[model samples]
Target chain A: MKASARLVVGLDPHGNSVVRVLRSQSPLTLVPARRVGPVALVHLVSSVTSPLGGDSLELTVEVGPGASLDLRGVAATLMLPGPTGLPSSSVLRFSVEGSVRYVPEPTVVTSRAHHTAVVEAELDGHAELLLREVLVLGRVGESAGTLSTSVRATRCGKPLLHQQLVVGSPSIDSSAAGLAGKRVVGTSLMLDAVPRASDGGEWWNVVPLAAGGTLATALGDDVVTVTRVLDAI
Target chain B: MLTALILADSRFPGGGHVHSGGLEEAAARGLVTDEPSLKSFLHGRLLTTGLLAAGFAAAAARGEDLELLDAELDARTPSPAQREASRAQGRGMLRAARRAWPSERLAALSRDPHQPLVIGVLVGDPYEAALTCAYLAVSGPASAAVRLLGLDPFGVNAIVAALPVEDVASRAVKELPALGSPALDLLAEAHVRREGVRLFGS
Candidate 1:
């Protein structure tokens, strides 16, 4: 039992305030297609209306020259089992000419659920991007499943960042790279700009990407503290 | 295998000693204050960063583009402090590698190429390259644990010897998924900023 979901949002400038969302799709699939407001000024605005879990999910987002957009995920996704204990997979591809912000809600790795997601983005010289992800091992008192993630981003066709994360399950010794013992973990990345945090808190571990970008990682005993640190960007 | 053995030696002057690979930071935060904790720390690192580095190292050993491999590595590394530490060591390693291997590939890299990329280019076999990378990834930290926590040297060595380095490399070569540790990343960021006596570079 393998189900699939796909969403493609293409944004181009129509006027100073309103941008055109040339492509938007959330066809009838296991993962719900839900969104609202391509509201003015900052290109198009869209989001995943509900929590999602499927055998495979593919997302392609394109921002036209000088356009800016924000893609949000409303609730955290739980990686439930597919038909035959098959792994859940999500592939996100981005083609950006201007800039894009993707701040999705956390995805919980429940017991026995194995999920892997890959994010690939190609950006123009002037384009910028912001991506944030949070992973929770269990709900209240439970061991975590397995979640593997990969990110590949390019600027002007040059690779800017290629990052990978595999956590939980196999390593019964320590859960989720040892961070689960402390509870929650999150990653925030910003390209072509510095992450300005008004809090000035010491919660985040920050770094500068070689070509051009910023990466930060934070953790907390609870989800709120970790999410709060990620929200700094 | 001989080349990997020589390079994997912490004494190869590749600047591997300068980095704690996040161990110093973790130990300070109380995440790794004891022997069992240290083992878990090393194991976690091996499964994530170690695996990824080995994967890239193995890929690089397969005659991949030097520039392309380094760029891909940059994309994979999300921590700035760790990134800087990597470049610093890379620069040091490149300098040493050029003198030893002295190839056109070594010369093509920028002033400070990444350490794994340098090792990848010089190693003859992908598995060897990966094993070398994986070995060093934890060996450096295990040594650091001895200095910082004054843990039994014998115990630390035992942990290193007990690791599934071969399995990690094999899986890495098969599919190196992107994985990161926010808690460790935070520790690294903090370690660099910590004012008092710092033992290792990263």
Candidate 2:
């Protein structure tokens, strides 16, 4: 399956954020809330079983000046293998002039599944973005297949943070320098001017980026433990 | 080749010895208590951070813009501790290289550039620079393992020798790698917050 979804949010004269353009494709549904407010709430629903091997998905989100968008996911996505044995891929691009919060639910990389996910965000001056991602290796008693996920965020054409994480390869996954044998990995990227003190634990930490922003990362045996650390940040 | 060898040498006084590359913390946590565990840690480090550094080194050696590479590397390295470690080593290497192999490119580097960029400017060959970077990435941690865990030196040397450093270097030269080592980053941060006796800087 191949799908492309687009959503654009802009501010009105009354200072209320409104969704100007919303185009949804199968498995990439965007449902906006009925409430009127300064911030627009949109729920991303996967209307169909998606992201199987050989599937390609793309989502583009743009926020105009002074607008705010709260985009969220409804449920966990399962990366299942298709019969073709090919790899699946998804690209999420965000262009922000105001603010955006993209909080997607956890994604599970099941056995035999191979997927590549990339998220690229461009923010101008005074723009803010918060992105959260939680990845589970596999279902109970099952080992993960393979996943290569990357995130690159830039502000005013200068890079803020860019990272690529690859999972699978039992050796690397179990290594102390890699995932440290953890089953769940989570990260929250906050690209705002908020100054946060450096804090961490045995398997989690929140650190300031060199250019600007803060990244909170946690690894654990279960989703709840990992998410708890990220939530604390 | 000689430049690469000298920069990779432990006695070069680049201050690379002060950083364990997260091995100290791993050993303190009992995550790498034995030879096998040390091998796993080194392997993971090689594939992720090692690959990323080697790519930047290769790019630098290919005569890429120093300012742009520095900023790009900073973007790639999210952890401030890790970034500090690299720049600290880079400053050390730069101070020494100024007298040994001073060049316009070396002067072009920022006040505190990345260690890989220093190695690249000194080596002047992409493959050799990447090879030097990838090897150093595991060699430091390997020696740190021997010191921190009291592992057999011969066994650790064997492990490091058997690692696929050449393969990683070759792959690094193809493109700039953005691989991120989450566990290593956590270990580095935890090491900074350990609030006790510490042997290595990072």
Candidate 3:
């Protein structure tokens, strides 16, 4: 009983929200039970019924400017071994609208669970975007499972941020120089917000922001500088 | 031997200790704050921006024309902040390499330097050369993060363990996708105008 789910979110002529879901080879899948609203949340679950071995759950969302959207999964996906006994994989595609804020929590990849995702966004001139994507080595205390994840953030047909991560060893500990030496790692990048430079001949300096834990460094004469933030520390 | 080490060291006095590859501005806006967020940021940068830049540097090391490589890098970088950062670091790296290993190739390239141009003249192996430079690019920011985050020594190792080096050699290329983040350039411009700042030139 394996299944594949496809959910599409779009903006209407008036800029209202519209959501659609196509499950398997069935007819047009529409959520009459749940109509689209200002803030839309859509979840499509694919089960262990496919010939490909493991199940897949994909989430797609479209957030308009001045609106919000959160698309979550039904449960933490477990990639069971295929008929050949190898781990299974899934693909997640996310397309964001202009002026919308999209934040998807850390996706937990159990031992041997391989997932690949492509996130593309086209933001308007005045839009603001704050997003965080995390792939854990394994289940927290237990430390079992492997996760491979890829992310791409784009604007106006160009790419902003793209990354691929694979974690085969959950329990094994290595140096921070490798991944800042943390079990949990996150990245926060902002565009169009150039930091102000200091006087003197030097072009860059690290300064503490309003928050005690946060640090801001303005480098060079460009309009943007992304600060590295480690959530675990 | 010492030439290789100097080019790879994070503390090479090349003024690379500044700039966070868009991390500083991202953090200021609350895009990234803690360990989890920082890791995510690094991962994305390495795969997209880091991957693309390494590829070009590798080509340069392999004897690609210095002018051609510099032009390639210039065209690939879309944002002003990133452009400035690349040139600033390139100039600094060229200056340092000239002093550390003063050879005909290094001296000639240093006259008008760019990141890939200097790297092509100094690095021995195309593959390893790119990896070493890429490592410095990632390591410099990560080290800066240590100072910015006030991270514990033990925790620092944890971060290092997270970077994947196995496939970096093959991934280094001159024409990877462009990782264009306009906000990063915006921040760099603003930083330059501000007075009494502490970081190096972008």
Candidate 4:
């Protein structure tokens, strides 16, 4: 299965943010709020069981100057394998001249599932973006399959953050130098003008990126613990 | 080839021994204690961080722009401590390379280039540079484990010998890798903040 979704948000003359374009395909539903405000809220709902093997999904979001958008997910996504045994992939591209906050639910990589997720965000000088991701290895008492997720954010054509994380290799997954045997991994990336001091604990830390922005990473045995760390950041 | 070997050597005076590549933090937390655990740690390091560094080194050896690679590497390494450690080691290596293998290309590098870039510029061969980087990634940590945990040197040597450094190097030469080690990044940050008698820099 192949799906593509697009969303465009812009600021109106009345100083209100409005959705100019909303295109949704199967398994990629977009719901917008009816109220008019400074920020436009959109909920992303999966209309069908998706991301099965051999599935390819793409989502493109564009935010015009002086506009703000908040995109949220309604439920968790389960990555399952299809009968063909092919791999699944998803690409999210964001072109922002204003601000965008994408908060999606956790994604669980079930057994025999192989998925590759990529997120590319291109921001202008005054643009800002906040992205959060939490990945669970598998269901309770189960082992993960395989997942390769990468995020690349560029500001004014300069790279801000580029990281690719691969999970489900038993040796690396359980090794201290890898995931440290943690079942859950979470990361929160904030690319704004706010300056935050570096802080962390034994398993979590919020640190400043090299170019600009702040990244908070947490590894825990459960989703709640990891989510709490990301929230606190 | 000699340049790669000399840089990989512990006695090269490149100041590579001070950074444990997060092994110190992992050991401090008791995550790695025995031979079996050390093997796992080295293997994991070889696959993730090791592969990433090797890829950058290979790109540099292939004559990629030093400044661009530096910025891209910075984007890949989100932890400040890890970045500082790499630059510090790079500075040390540059100092030595200026006296030994001085060249216009070596001089073109920034004052404090990433360690892998330095290795790549000196080696000038993608595969060899990648191999040198992949080996150094786990070798330092393996030695640090022996010093910090009182593990047997022979056992640690065996573990290091068994790592997949060549395989990682071969793969790294194929393309630039952005593999991020979450546990290693967290450990690097925590190591910097730990308030105690720390032996390694990172």
How large a fraction of the reference contact set does each model reproduce?
A: 0.57, 0.94, 0.00, 0.96
**What does candidate 2's lDDT look like per residue over B75-182, in tens digits?**
999888899999999999999999999899999998899999999999999999999999999999998888888889999999999999999999999999999999
Per-model TM-score (chain A alone):
0.77, 0.99, 0.56, 0.99
Q: lDDT for every model?
A: 0.71, 0.95, 0.49, 0.95
Off by over 4 Å in 4: none
Clashing pairs in 1: A161-B75, A162-B75, A162-B76, A163-B76, A164-B178, A164-B179, A165-B178, A165-B179, A207-B80, A208-B80
Give the per-residue lDDT digits (tens) of candidate 1, residues B155-174.
99998999999998888777
DockQ of each: 0.53, 0.94, 0.09, 0.95
Superposed on all Cα atoms, the candidates' RMSDs to the truth, in angstroms, are 4.1, 0.7, 10.9, 0.7
> Where does candidate 1 stray beyond 4 Å?
A1-54, A170-180, A194-203, B175-177
lDDT of 2 at A2: 96
Clashing pairs in 4: none
A17-56: candidate 4 lDDT, tens digit per residue: 8999999998999999898998999999999898999999
In Å, residue B96's CA in model 3 sits off its true spot by 6.4
* Candidates 2 and 3, the one with greater TM-score: 2
lDDT of 3 by residue, B47-143 (tens): 5456666777777677766665565455445344466677777888877776677777665563545565576567767677767666665666566
Interface RMSD of 1: 3.0
Chain B TM-score for the candidates in order: 0.95, 0.99, 0.83, 0.99
